[model samples]
Target chain A: MFIDGRALPAGTALEADIAIVGAGAAGITLARALKDSGLSVALIESGGLEWSEEAQDLAAGELGPQTYATPDTVRLRYFGGTTGHWGGWCRELDAIDFEPRDFVPLSGWPLKKAEIDPWYAKAQSVLQLGSPQRYADSEGIAKAAGAALPVARGGDIEPILFEFSPPTRMGEVYRAELEQSAVKTYLNTTLVDLRVGDDTRTVTTLTLARDGGPALAMTARHVVLATGALSNAQMLLAADSQVQGGLGNGADQVGRYFTDHPILIGYAAILALDPSAGGPFAFGDIAADKRRWRLAFQPSEAYRAAQKRLSCLITIEPPGPRFDPAAGAFDRSDAKWFGAPETVNALAAANATGPVRLHVLNAGIETRPNPDSRVTLTGKRDRFGMRRLKVDWRLSDADLEHYLLNLGDFAKALAHSGTALLRIPPDAAARWPEETSWGHHNLGTTRMGDDPRTSVCDRDGRVHGMANLWVAGSSLWTTPGAANPTLTIVALALRLADRLKAEMAA
Target chain B: MSDPVARAWAVTRRTFGATLLGALGLAAVETWPRWAFWRGAASSLDALAGLPQAAALKALGRQAQAAMAIPAGYADTLAARLGDEGYAGAVARDRAEGRLVSIDGWLVPETQALAGLWLASAG
Candidate 1:
């Protein structure tokens, strides 16, 4: 049942069979999965049922050389976490995402996509995305949507599908189940410190702080950190008093390899002759079976292998302003014409005799795992005296180059198919990060791997060298694919839930 | 030089000036199979010819020809048999075959880029 952690008297020592920290997508999934396992579970959340300004301010942190959404602004501190504002785009990671690619450094996960396929099926329902089977049946999905997949003839680029959620807000959808379950749910409780035994391997006690209440502690047979990517790293890196670098920092790997899918908003435009309105090839999202669907293009496996390019998901947007190069000399300033919608159609319209303008293209590209792009502690501290995080989210030069190359090839593939003409911005390279935005899907700080020297967690989500302590959420990702991360985050959480149940039973 | 294409080029240079003429004469001699399409007055083709993208468009046309394995004199064959509108049909065909090139960063069929080059030089 829900218990306001703040109402608990000073120095209350709560005990449970399992203590799960930060009740977001990952934590809530675990709590729900283990709700009836007969193990007493303590689910602690920093914010109460609603938004609180004080709680949100605790997430404020500094930025790096590149400009990013400030921590507090990009993330929600209350229940449901960032899902409270997510767009609900969901796609499973490609098989290649789990393999070690020679082109990508620190790439590949210890577990293959197949290892968690069952969990993904379960996660589909948990995410409110119907029928896990539909994701694999491409032709059926296209038939059901009543639209032909773009470039259906086949090329270096092929259409990939994304299933939309009613965007199941976990906090609200499961609030009743949580309330009815046997678990002890602590709201408005922030984990402050982790006390380890003399060996510094097992987390013995967890100290939590409430805004208006005195300090409280929780001891559990097993401890799980499911506080999203940035916060998981922040919490782990902050608990350095007992173990020097942090609880899982024996390899100095905690807070390293942070990543987000870098998106190119309006880098190119497409001109087609009277594109089918609301079709898969047309710009805009489509709906079928009471669910919204979006069709985006990705490089085929052959294309990536042959070109050594990174993965990217390219979507077409409706036509807007016309950047007419036909009217005058195509000057450098005309580069601004990109992202201008009507240019594609205007160009097509200008040709009067045939071919009409189509749409603009937006691409969200993947970045390689670079240790230099990481999260670190700043001297500034929050109200709880915990050092605020400094996010240094970096994208290497090759990352942008690879994305543009993949885009150019995709444009060629479209033309080859007699579908449309794509106009890539001439100055795309010059604009770099200035023209790029992020997925806001923070990932890969406490990555899972077999090597403690390189990763903070093992294949089972257990922090390296630490017993009975586990790290959850996207923070456990070894590589961030171009796919939006929530589905995978939930899938992995379910997988971990099964493992945790077995461990407790043993 | 007495060919109608030469006559059209004369009009084009006079209309748009010589500096922007670029390699129009050389491009025409090497790539244009038949210059009959230049029989009209200096049209919108003249404007495109004067743009900075004209050079790259010519180069892309040549690259497209090589990539698509189109005969060197195929342009003349199409123009001779199909007339001025033949290039547009060829662009559609080239697009269907996936024979494309990037000119000024705009992805266009190889035949389209070649036609742009031909028009720039044909006039």
Candidate 2:
């Protein structure tokens, strides 16, 4: 099961009623949901039981427009995929994201927020998080010397409501459950290509190559690709028989709409509420979303009104008497493992002479989607003999503009709220560091919509061209609201599971 | 209407709107970890090579983080070592100016490693 540098078990019987290409949050969640179905399932992963050097390499290097600047954000080849080391920040997509926002173009999900509300309720138990109802206890957190998030009133652009766990590591938390499954789990196996019936576009068989051997073929009644964003597109592009462009290449939409949360940090420092009073990006002053305790941001009323739509979270950390060793509050493992040293070096230099900034607040903003921002087949193969992905991440100028604008006002508010306002000089671009990469919430690649022409999948995560192929996870996100998207991804996966089950029964 | 604070507020509000508003409506375009391309392109032509896990996840360690929020005098050491690429010295500067002080709310379960500066370091 854990063989390396080669392909699948030699001459292995590769037949299953249902086949899932990844063993991540999406695949594992779905496999468990479909347990009793008469259909046998196959879950194939490129990596093995735990983290490995081989897997880490897939997460590194540059791929077209899809660049993995922060290798730490993903566990490229693992049993639970990247969920092997997730930060557990959970939140549901806003009602606005599900509904057609009057002002947002190419917005809206096939299903409504109400449809997934029940699913979110169920997912909470799986993630081992507290109930969503009592999530926000801002007053309680505020009483602490420094709570990082502020209390948020639901119903702005995103009426976000959900909670986070200390962070549910998929490998540590779900290994037992997976082992108990009757489902066949093929580790160290990568989906290299798809063979299609000449006339019909339906995928006839899945070809997998593990380590480095001749490809092995798999036949299945249905195929579900729960591969992370980059690999999902890579597999489709490599499936050359049915379509040269890729499996869901009808509109050439596989890698398009490449969007990452433009998380700007240190751009603004809330000047001086009381260094003692708790305001800004400090832990104590951080406003929670409804009942949740995490610090979050939304468009400033000014930006909201004009529709700049970008929002920033304020984290005013309590002047720590000492760092909480128990909480391990400061050891950002993901950052250390994946951060570009050159970039952080520049960021640190920019902040070399400031007050003890309480917390580093991130501004998670949505970027405009461009069809050109996409994944193309690089024709380069990994050790597994499959092609790599090319990432074209183009950000809009408008993003940088407002973060700076908000920075100025934020500093002013902090000053008025209390301190000697801190500011980044207007021309400090060169002095500033490379922007912060997102938290691996890869979204919008196979965006969902009513029309198949514009998007790759329908609202329920079913691929348009294929009857049995489905996708869940951030990839279906048309609008990744400012909230952390894992909870939403889980919600969508649950929704898809329920739909699939119901349809199977019908 | 002519009060200095009010004047400052008005000018400040307009400037904020001017710069950050027009770009509203759009959201999250570039992706996180968008690295599949160059590696794939290289591999496509039979040129892809693997890197070490320690190097693959080199960013996941504490040394870099410890170095990120060095005390005022610490950066000068690396400053000489990294002449052109020396960190703009943001940590040292932010510390001296009280800018990096107690960022109370800007934390997640684990962000200390990123900045290292805490309340004791605050003014």
Candidate 3:
């Protein structure tokens, strides 16, 4: 049943066995998993089934140093969460990402990749992506495309694969399923505060409100915080009536170690292959099994281990219409070749005939978790009187060093193979790009770990020292990997659901 | 004749001469492209011997004319050399100037060089 919080009377109190805040990808996946499990579930969302400006303003926050998408614009406040605009690129984190590395500070996950492989399979189905076997069998793509990825193994670089989704929007994809289930969804209800007991360990009541409506309260045996990375920390920091700093923030680790994948245009090169030979290098056709895949390049695990560098993935893009001379109107006589006119003329003549294929290189670099890069509370409050967030996202010199070194290695590998000649201006490698871009993947604010002193939540996604409070989102990530986080986010949510089910049965 | 001052002066002069020759040798290696430009251009035609297409030779000629700032008739001589045994030498000149590079049997201009040509053609 869908309940409009606007229609509720003042002081209305709802009861359920499980009360989940934020009806996004994680919330919806958990609700679906708990359906018909003999437990009553209340899934609450801040917005209606669609977009609302008033609801989005609740996410407004200050960007401290870097230029980043505002919290309000980077994420959607609707039922589906940020998946509403996601590109649906999905890849599982490599085993190396979960291991404790000597070079990477604050790296390592409490759980191994094997522990979550089963949930990843289930997540594949929920995402409407094809079978996991398809990703395991790369030869299928080579057979279907009739050409292999021009990359070879046993070198400094290796090819990695990514699968695309119909870019599944959970609200649209699972709306009917949610309506048919026993989970009761309350739309336009915002989580205002969490009333904890005197011990500061157990949450007793949750205060909720809607625009132009009376405030309501909810009581539950178990509460799950599925709000995204930014809001999850914001909610925890704001719910500080019982604790001095915030609930589950005794170690001051609640909002620290914030991270995002820093992206930039790495290099440019021409594939020595003829235009006809470019077909195999392009995004592979959706196989007969309805799975579309693309290949990217990354340094091998051995190389990374030897170099002690963070993981990064290089994406190749074909030259678009921007390369067409007819489309571009520019003066050649005034063209400066950096003192190489013969080379310039030869390049123009080659481009006019379109004999060789051009490729642009872009990469996503993993920024190490830093205690200084964090989210803290601002003096100003939101519509519900909760303190707003102030985000200080930063990147270290190590991050820049890892990106440039790996790119240099990749360029050399291409040149050595006689496949292409890579060109990156010397200055570009000396410093980070002036304007850094990100995929809006917020992570690590409420990271998980075995030790309560280092992480906000335990390995099972439970808040430290709290029996019934848990977090479910990318916020629970121990370390952000090079791959997109949606697949892992959904997988972790499903794993949390199973734990909740087993606990309830016990 | 056995004075220590005269003996020291002779040793110093020999050491200085050897150091100067070593420095010159290193400089030549570093600045080979600039110093060898004429020799490399004269031999550029050798680099194109492997190319099978006459049109490819003509294209190289045109690029050479524009790059060398020579008249149209001079371009024909460069183009003929491009199709002869000296094609490799001609290509060496272009490569030294950052004009041409070979990839998978096809000789093409570097991306920067192409951009320059495109701009010139647009004008």
Candidate 4:
């Protein structure tokens, strides 16, 4: 049963097999997966079903130091978590995302892409995305985008597609299943503390609050935190009783290794191919990988490297006389002409046509993993008196260097391929000398790895020090790649659920 | 529960007055996307009713975009960086920010503007 954060029940303690916190993408996915099982689960969320201004504001970068999904970015803080506001783009973590890179320090996942492949298929089925397990579908997508994308010899590229589900709301999707289960969802019952034993070995109980009421202590055999990247480590460090620094903080790595795919509107232009919109193209088209998807682009090696993902979307050109959809230029969409996306589109169009007949889509660059810029709990408490998260987030210099290098190098490659042109390459170069940053994708606080010393959680997401505790969501992403991370988060939660189920069975 | 000090100082009244305009603005925004579509649909329907032939589309486009405007969020964020004030200003700034392609002027901007005009005209 759900409880309000401001109103506490008369009871002193509640018991459950699994005490899960924050029903975002990670929490909700795991909860739903474990719903049918008879094991008791108490799913807690700080926000109610609908939009709350306070909760939304808390998600914003302007209000908080950590910013992935802001008030404007997501309709978060509900049962479904952040999925309500997702654009429905789904892709598996690249096989390379698991490997350690000599170039990128502190990069690599202990688990590999092979282990995740089965999970990806399961995730695809759950998301109801079309099949993407084959190359024929990818070829179909390449054809859909038009004949410009060069077919590779090595089969080096992975074809990832966007799935627009009836907007997967984690809460609503799992609501019916959860109602009949042993799992009890506690909405507005915020977790205040994750107390551990005297030896800081196991999680004893979680101190939770119902809005303005006195805290309730709940004991559980296991506890998992899926409260996003910023909030995950925030809660860990806030549990001051167990360790001086935080839970699973034996290495003082509670809030280190933060990374995100920082996006930039790179060179954009007018394609020479006139757009015939009605024929074979729609923003919502189907690709062969059993995934219904849209236009795709090949990100650069420097950009789409291990732990780095750059999802470059090539949108339909703006419907105008001189716009060329085939050449990656000339968009008449509002993005090019009206709002922010439109404005960027317009910039691309102008750059692609006239004296310069080329527009390159924005490069969504991934940053180097930096352990210094991270999140921690400030002594100051939130509505629950749990230490509110104090986040210090920033893009690193390596991020900028690679961003520029990849952009330049890719522009050169496209020019060499005779598939692209830079209207004013020198000008594009000049403008990039000064660095600017934006916050949308926050990642890597409680990063995942086998070693307890460097990472907060084990490969399966169990907290290193506490066997019963696990970290979920983007917080567990040791390094974020170039794609939007929502899909990856869902995939990770699904994996964690299997482990949880097996453990309970044992 | 009203705070005694705030009540005594008439803060509630003042705060309410201050937010009155913002509330209206939000209401306008909430309805704008739908409104745009509504006007667009109405114009197209009217065109089909009035002139079922050549210019039905052309007529519909104009009606929808009669009051077409960009959201203030863009103006506050990307536009300011690019040096734009409003919708037209934002587009103009966006075009200006790009490297000059036309020997004298960029043709794509005009084409984009025409497209916007078309989308708006359908209203």
Q: What DockQ does candidate 4 score?
A: 0.01
Q: Write down the TM-score of every candidate.
A: 0.83, 0.67, 0.80, 0.68
Per-prediction DockQ comes to 0.19, 0.01, 0.03, 0.01
| Model 3 misplaced stretches (Cα beyond 4 Å) | A136-139, A266-276, A284-288, A329-349, A430-433, B1-123
Top candidate by lDDT: 1
Q: For candidate 3, give the docking quality class from DockQ.
A: incorrect
| Candidates by lDDT, descending order | 1, 3, 4, 2
Candidate 2: C-alpha lDDT: 0.55
What TM-score number comes out for model 1? Answer: 0.83
Model 1, span A1-506: residue lDDT tens: 99998898887879988999988889999999999999999999888888889889888898898877888887887777777788888889988888888988889999998998999999998999987666545556677778766576346887777889989888899999999999888999999888999988888999898878777888888999998888899999999898888888988899999988887877776655333433555446667767777778888867787788899999886543332335543223333533232332233334332324345677888889988889999999988888899999998889989888888887787776655657777777887887678888898999999888889999989998888999889998888878999999999999999999999889
Better of 1 and 3 by lDDT: 1
Q: Give the per-residue lDDT of model 1 (tens digit) for B1-123.
A: 579999999888787866456567767644552333333425424333443234434434443433444447645643443343334455567766677666546788766665544643453
Q: Model 4: runs farther than 4 Å from truth?
A: A1-8, A54-75, A134-136, A144-160, A267-291, A299-360, A416-419, A423-439, B1-123
lDDT of 3 by residue, A1-506 (tens): 88899898887879989998998889999999998788999999998899989889998989977877788988899889888999888888877888788888888899898898999999998898877656544556656756555557567887767888888999999999898889999999999898888777888898998887767889998999998999999988888878888888999999888888887753334444334446545543434445677677788778888888889988876555544567672134222211134544555455556555445566788878787889999999887887888888888878878877887677656544434545554345444544568878988899999988889999899999888899999998877879889999899999999999998888
Q: What fraction of the reference interface contacts is present in each model, in order? A: 0.46, 0.00, 0.04, 0.00
iRMSD (1 decimal) for each model? 8.4, 14.1, 8.9, 14.2
Predicted candidate 2 versus true structure: per-residue lDDT over A329-398, tens digit per residue: 4324322211244423322322222232323334566555566766566656666666666676666566
Q: Name the top TM-score candidate.
A: 1
Report the Cα lDDT for residue A372, model 1.
Answer: 82
Report the lDDT of model 2 for residue A175.
70
